[model samples]
Target: MPQLTQTEMFLAVLVAIFALPYAVWRLGRTDYYAPLVVVQIVGGILLGPGVLGAALPQLHATLFTPDVIAMLNGIAMWAVMLFVFVAGLELDLKAAWRWRGETGTTAALAFTTPMALGALVAGALLLLDARGEWVGAEGQDWQFVAGVGMACAVTALPILVLFLEKLAILRQPLGQRVLRYASLDDLAIWGVLALILLDWERVGRQAAFIALFVPAVWAMRAAMVRLAERDRWYVALVWVALLGLAADWSGLHFMVGAFLAGAVLDGEWFGTERVDRFRDTVLLALMPVFFLSTGLKTQWSAGGWAVAMFALALLVASVGGKLGGVALAGRLLKWPRGEARLIGWLLQTKALILIIFANVLLDKQVITPATFTALLLCAVASTMLTIPFATPALRQLDTHRA
Candidate 1:
């Protein structure tokens, strides 16, 4: 392959880096968050070997590679960590504390029902050999089931946060409830994923290490928080380095450490505005590379009946499971029937977190390329469907608030 001129390389990098953020800022002006995901996908296809080269015939292959792809993953994961940390910082711990019982119960119902359903559906698909024969090194049918289950059960934290912010519900009771419950939901799903990864006999030591490391890290963090109250940035830099090293050493991804560190920092220690400012700077600088990397890793050719079926199954499980579970809890809790149903529908949006976890499973070989593609399609579709589906429900909530 011929190498690109320096000019070409520079232009390509510039476009790849700035395109998503520009689109996001523009979309924000119009009050649409759903289009950002579509923009990323479309941008990738356009800049990829498929469209740009076909149209221009002068673009080089230097823009795409495995190493660049890996770097993108690291950046994206860091962005996710910053995003989640900002979320944790935004949590009004006092309010969440008061609603702990309700939030815990609601989140439990919301998560467990979907997970069980996703796993069962995955098992059925595997048993029937729907997505290939599951003949890869990750075992036969059950392993596939667990992998699919984990994917289906995930909720998109970033998307959820964006939606709440857009809907002006972030400071409201319902929004606060959803955020707290969703945080719990994220924690639960991560735990379940860790367990599934271990059960599948992939990275057993890593899983064990995370399980042991989290509390110990938190305890240490608490102590550090007390001492560093006088010098916030000092504490931030130290914790960031410590967590990153610990994650690398434990064989877990550095993003995991970043996230844990952010979660520990919360707003209690650093104040919400300061944390948000730092998060924005990090996200603006590093997060687009992550999304671009995801686009680069996506395989458009991984399509067939099995992939289609799995995609359909993902849609069903994500929607049916979350909606059904939350609806049940809402009724049991004596929330108005309509409000309960709205909660079910609003929780359906899946975003960057789903994609991140999918990438992890793909890297671990827990899921095949075909399965990964299917899940990606599900993530895209679920995210798009969410805004339209939840609009009426959200409008109702708004009216109630008014």
Candidate 2:
């Protein structure tokens, strides 16, 4: 019978985030395909408009009031920026280069085929699409088409790593090879995103950022190497904030800067084990809020069936394109069918990064709320399908090899 203050609501929100996902994860035993992250994502959507808001407007309003949403968003922003920073830091460019021929071919095929397929789907949507805000604020139809398509091409490198670790293959040769392939795609995904988000008006500022970033990165790297590992953590946060500000000011978005901040840093300097533990801490504690905030943004005003249909189409594009690309590479490179099949399925697994990419598209108005809803659905489905199908392939491959 009482309305809670913003602080109280925030606490309640946090409690619900952690409690709901953990309960569903533990009780439902969704470990194989649906991890805690997937559970959290589903919980977020259920907590958002398509379900909860559509069903109980009064309760949804009471819990997620304007002030409460703003506060939660602020927390989510920082959490995601840091989480993205960690993603960049974990990339192994050298390893990708070392296995360049195989990794390059596979990554290229995986990305390009899905991108083209997704673009075709988007183009088909464009013939009759009536949503105005679905297109970028200052962008064109081609940009939206390409943007949505690339969204399908993404593989959540961070989530892939988690899945690999869960399967007890993080250190295995196969796991390491897959990581290399995923790492290259990670770089390409961000590059294409930057192209999609290009603001002609801010071209000068962006140019300045490019000119300044190289020196700043050098200085930051040098200072980081000199500092104690314990102190580097504190410095890294400060650096993330500063770089994020620069990126935003240049119209590139703070998340982009956060990623770049970590990308330039040597993962070795941070100690792999400590970094892993820290990543886990962020995912366990802060990322749930980000996921909830993401859920709050979901909208399906364009008809649930329409969104579902497009999502289904995009899902087909993502899975089929990834598998096709990998299959073609296997043929050219002469890899076994089982290994290629397993790798292709794993590469199709999408989560955090794809969601983040879609969030950016939504933020920039490059895609409408309805399009975002479809993409989000596609991402979740793509991720959940991974373990269930890939596990069988992995087992068969192991048997074949043995």
Q: What Cα-based lDDT does every candidate model obtain?
A: 0.66, 0.89
Cα RMSD (Å) per model?
Answer: 4.0, 1.2
How accurate locally is residue 270 in candidate 2, as Cα lDDT from 0 to 100?
A: 84
Q: What is candidate 1's TM-score against the reference? A: 0.82
Task: Mark the regions of model 1 whose C-alpha exceeds 4 Å error after superposition.
Answer: 1-11, 20-38, 45-60, 65-74, 84-97, 130-143, 199-219, 227-231, 301-306, 398-402
What's the TM-score of each model vs. the native?
Answer: 0.82, 0.98
Q: Highest TM-score: which candidate? A: 2
lDDT of 2 by residue, 1-402 (tens): 686888898789889999988998999898987999999999999999779999999888889989989998998899899889999998999999998999999999999999999999888887776646356455589878988889889999888999888778889998998899889999998999888878899999999999999999889988998999989989998999999999989998899989998899988888999889888999998899999999999998888898899899999999999999989988989997598899999998888888898888888788877888888899999999999998899999989988
Looking at model 1, residue 262 earns an lDDT score of 62
